[model samples]
Target: MKESVNSYVFHHCVTIPTIRKGGPRNNTKTYSTVDDAENHLSPQHFCLPHTLFNRSFLVAVILLELGFGSIPMATSLDTSSTYSGILSSSSPCFVRPSGSGTVYYYQAIQVTVFAWGMHTFSSSSLMDTFSCLYNETFFPDRSSQNLIESDDDSNGAHQFRIRLNLQPGRAYILVVTTFSEIVTGSFQITATGPMQPVLSSAQPITTTASYVLSSSSPEFARPYAYDYNNVPYQAILVTVSMTGMYTFKSSSSIDTSGYLYNEPFNSSDSYRNLIISDDDSGGNLQFQINASLQSSHSYVLVVTPYRKAVTGRFLIEAAGPERLELTTYRHSAGPYSCGNKLTCKAGGLLKIIKSMVISVGCVGLLIGVFCCRPCTNKRKRTLRQQLSLLRQNPISQANSIPLRNVSINTGRTNEIDRPYTISISTVAATYAEQPPPTYEAAVLSSQR
Candidate 1:
């Protein structure tokens, strides 16, 4: 019997011009024109016409006007694993190197890299002191710029820990050695992203998901003299199902910086293309990232010590449906703030508003027509009276008069919009000094 190796990776291969002895695979038809291919009938042909986005926008607007609509966002942690390695350092210094190893993972995300002396029966494990190094260099050497962060204990203990915003499909090296002189020992290394709570509920049986992070929870160590991996912090992830606003905050004692990512932290690209990053909304030293998120996508949220220094365990929260708080902070000062996005709390309002729109909209429209009909008729009558008055005035009735229509904007709420067509002859007759009147009027008056 042959045994299969579980450690080997499997790959897929595609052969070009893949023609079979029979017809094309799956009896697929070939098209000479691009139009034919575009119109090809398939399961994807009868899709929903890509119209949901427009409808969703309209629905969102209506929901807002009705004062109701909120979206849901799901927060979860990345899955992680641990690995083992050995380190030996002789005459260890910043100059002469000792031992280094790398860890690789898929799907870049903000990661918490933990490296400390693993407990073993050997006494060397007790005396073993190690410093962790991290960076993005394909082959990380001590002198490369890829080495952004390194950590050593302040009190000179044999343990080291650091957290970094790491990228996916990238490599990071963790180096361990004695602080100054010769030392060697076995060590354990583990990298973990924030994890989802175990007792998760579809409805979330509790108000929120709770977590406790501290130096003991996952040892975060700062390396000596920034040779590699610099920023050490754990990142939590939250997936949003709808495009809406969300708020993330942490209460840690360390001055904290919170970062929001459209994609999980995998490379330098994650930092450059940030969804939102906030160091401190106020001078309170708390981190907060507030932004609107799109649906059907995962967002990574990282809450870390402000500067990769000593930090105390603190609770953090990611919450939504900020309608109340949102209204309060409409034009507040720089210190106070509400989320800067929309939410799903209005879904209930959407339903009620839709119902009201159906019933009330029809009623209001009918009332508008009924009330406006009389006003319209009254306006026509008023216009006729005004024209009659113009005719009664002798100057307006005169022949050979240059009649000019004039527009007069009325101040009355019920005034008609039709322009008041006052003749130029009327104005001239009213103001000009009559030269004993026009010839015909003069003759008629003399005869009378």
Candidate 2:
């Protein structure tokens, strides 16, 4: 009976009775104890164990199987450590310095317990999606050789596993981020190695990104130091995922200045939205600004020269607790304007010229309609009246003066008293507004 109890506890084998054709019979049947022990122990078995000793042994086995001393089953050493955390909007984000890709929550896991062996890093998502990245350097954008390995998913599961040989007593950064942007949830990470590896929560890494300011960039007025002049500037639209203080510094051969605006940057009204400005604080005529920023909020960072009309190429370095999404921002063009300062000013001059031309044309049109057009009409009417008068009475040029026939004496007078006579027709010319002369009058005038 004691042997039977031991078999059930250790080997999980149970004894059962069987029915035969002859009569009431007892044939021991073995059952696996891996399953529920209560299911295998039937009420009929109580009757089979007729003695009190076997009943006590059976009770002891049942108690052990029911989880009273289950830890005695050869439990191996726990050579792994687990950490749990949640990724939310409050978590620091990881962003690409190139400003392209999904933003990830910069979750860092610092190896606490030091071990001298190859470490296997694995992570599993509890609620939402996540991934794993192993790196030696705290900040990846500064050093490219820090990335040891990365894994998105393992065998189509929301878990990642990476095997890397890590140095003992040295800090190893494990970045647990999500697969998509703004995806937040809970996760679990386990680090297993030859020795126990303890993982603890660590602070977010400092994110640094570089950009340039050139001639073709935007321009704004320096609102600081009572100076309001247009200076060429580069506007960077910064979107931070974590709330903390950020530093911006400029590096260039020319004198550079920095300005931070809380909301949208307006060139015309830059002073109204100014949050902070720095000039020559970074040393060597460069600008350095340190301001507190918030998450889910946007800001404009303007890098310009300290003086007006100064333009050149310059580099901007932004450092923050979490990664910043930096994009080159250009102001939208107006209806009759362009983006660049030169083109926009040219457009304004063109608009002024256009307005002046329109005004001159309107004045000339008024003069022609009211003054010059009436004078032209009066002169045309006078010329028409004179033409009608000429058409009414025609002037006869041949009968302007009266003439009559006459006889003249010549050397041919000795020819039987014959004389040469000349004759002319009688006609009279008339003027406008005067009657024609009678034929008798015309004949009398000619004779006289």
Best candidate according to TM-score: 2
lDDT of model 1 at position 389: 78
| Pairs clashing within candidate 2 | 12-33
TM-score of each: 0.23, 0.36
Candidate 1 has a TM-score of 0.23
Q: Write the per-residue lDDT of candidate 1 for residues 1-448, one digit (tens) a residue.
A: 1122333633221111212233323443554543343344221211122223233433432333233434321234354455444442211123223335221111111223333222111012353444444454312123334454555553235555555554444445454444444344555444455431111111101113334345543222222213213455554556555444444666656676666655434333334335777776523787655465565655556555655445566555654422111100121333222132232234446778899989998999999999998987788779768866775787766752443534454444454365354666667766687466789988999999
Residue ranges of candidate 2 with Cα displaced over 4 Å: 1-78, 96-102, 132-134, 140-145, 205-268, 271-441
* Candidate 2 residue 41 C-alpha distance from true site, Å: 55
Candidate 1 deviant stretches above 4 angstroms: 1-229, 267-272, 322-448
lDDT of model number 1: 0.43
Model 2: weakest 10-residue lDDT segment is 16-25
- The lDDT values for all models are 0.43, 0.62
How does model 2 score by TM-score? 0.36
lDDT of 2 at 417: 26
